[model samples]
Target: MRILLALLYVSLVGAPGGSSLPANDSFRNTIQSILNIGQITLFHIKKLRTKLPAAPQMEFSTPSIDGLTSISRDLQILDNELQNPVTDLLSQIQADVSSMEGRVRLFALTMGCPVQARPRGHPWASLFPDSHFYLILEKVQRYLDTIFLNKDKLKVC
Candidate 1:
């Protein structure tokens, strides 16, 4: 009886069949890739901007226009890569992230917490208290914000 109970306990706790561990890892990897792409984009943008001659109108010169077009193409590729639903892990992560965001928002509203507090140490933050999910979402958001704020920095490389 004791051995049977122990075997059952071990099976329940150690099995991966019911776990989202793989999905979590995939999400983390995706977020890291996004951040790396953002860094590369920023670098390209800065290089192009620095190479430009100093003139208000010259900012939109031929070279700059060409660089911008290249940058745009790179961005499109990145967007397509992100949008591809090739892996079940990514799809699950995306769905979970969206659902978690919704739940966080709802919880915050119910608890009277500010929107900014939804990501971190807020009363309602515990709604999606899973560390892996939170970390992936936070990284994704950070990368997205960096891309948005440095939009002009994305130059053709």
Candidate 2:
């Protein structure tokens, strides 16, 4: 939860105007929620790996990790530049995150890791499950679409 809180703080601090625009505030809230969901997904992945008897020798591609890192950096850049946000930028970033999540899901599948549904809890707490990485990814993507990428009308950050 500390990681989630730290991420939320960083995102809010980086966003432009500090809650002047309702849309921007909504975007910040959505992004924070996305990060928290991601943390839960990552936590489960780590827990599963540690639960293995002997680390279940598996070869994950380095490119996948590198790609994720690149996406994360770009997301940070976009978050920082939210003062003049670009719709396509967020769309592409959302797509990239989804792709990375897919890679993680495939990697887990190859290693025989199970993906489970979210457990019952507080609404926010129940957004993502330990094994529901793709679900978390989808939720983030959809939130970005609804809050930042509305095709019906453009949002000028």
Candidate 3:
């Protein structure tokens, strides 16, 4: 009876074809590792934003304004690539980056913050008491817009 019980235990513990249980555990561990990496990346991004020098007002120019137009065009191209019937990972990453670039450009423009440079710190942050954090909030909103808009474009590769 003890021998029969031991055999049963081995069969239940082992994978089909006699693959080691450790191998399956390793696979699960790897998946968890990847998830942990993603979480760390997000945390690092938040930390970096906190450490950034205050955003300055941007100066608009024919060339700078034109850059934004070019950026928008790039976004359209990325979007088109993502919408292709045969979708892949690289196309998705490009779409995400393009979307992010567009939103950042747009937010900077709308906030009356110079895309070039206004001053060392955000003037609007201090001058507009009622809207003290409006510029920063706008930037965050733009980031969210980019992320949600291009989420489907994310590529594992």
Candidate 4:
């Protein structure tokens, strides 16, 4: 399950589109991709929840699952908002992203996984072909951090 989620994170947010669109257009496109990836992550998290046994090892089973479900529902609302083109939604979208980041981090800590905290404000131009990849890259890094930190914890569970 960790491998699957990692692969999904990499594929969904790994590559940045290098189109020569205007700055405004590129920002919008990147935001759209971020939103789409957010939805995908929520769905996969749901699937992961289903696979967890009714009786679990970890102490965080109830609250963690509840939090994930709540986030999934919130993402659905954000999805509806995304259908209409608007920059005003960016703040809300970013807030949702932040919430997911914290939840994922807590999930990792609960699972006892080691998280890889990437240095903040790293240059995307070196890792990605496009500079506009920051949003998704940040998401990917956060997810990766959670996974890297908690793999051992998962084994114990």
TM-score for each of the candidates: 0.30, 0.28, 0.26, 0.26
Q: After superposition, how far is residue 118 of candidate 3 from its true place, in Å?
A: 40
**Per-model tally of clashing residue pairs:** 1, 0, 6, 7
lDDT of 4 by residue, 47-98 (tens): 5446543422222111122233333333333233323232332344445455
lDDT of 1: 0.39
Candidate 4: list runs displaced more than 4 Å. Answer: 1-89, 122-157
Candidate 2 wrong stretches, greater than 4 Å: 1-20, 56-157
Please give the RMSD to the true structure for each candidate, in Å: 18.8, 21.1, 18.1, 23.5
Off by over 4 Å in 1: 1-14, 17-19, 55-74, 77-157
Query: What digit string (tens of lDDT, one per residue) describes model 2 on residues 1-157?
Result: 9999999999988776655597556645644554544555444444544543433233322211222233333333322322112223233333444443444343334334543332223222333233233333333434334423332111111
Error of 2 at 70 (Å): 12
What tens digits encode model 3's per-residue C-alpha lDDT throughout 60-155?
222111233343343343333333333232333334444454554454354344453212321222445323232333333343344344433221
Comparison by lDDT, 1 against 2, better one: 1
- The TM-score of predicted model 1 comes to 0.30
Q: How much is 106 displaced in model 1, in angstroms?
A: 29
Q: What TM-score does prediction 4 earn?
A: 0.26
Worst 10 residues of 3 by lDDT: 116-125
lDDT per residue (tens digit) for residues 69-138 in model 1: 3323333322332232332333433443334334334433443444432222212222433332333333
**Pairs clashing within candidate 3:** 57-114, 58-113, 58-114, 58-115, 59-114, 92-153
Q: What is the lDDT of candidate 2?
A: 0.38
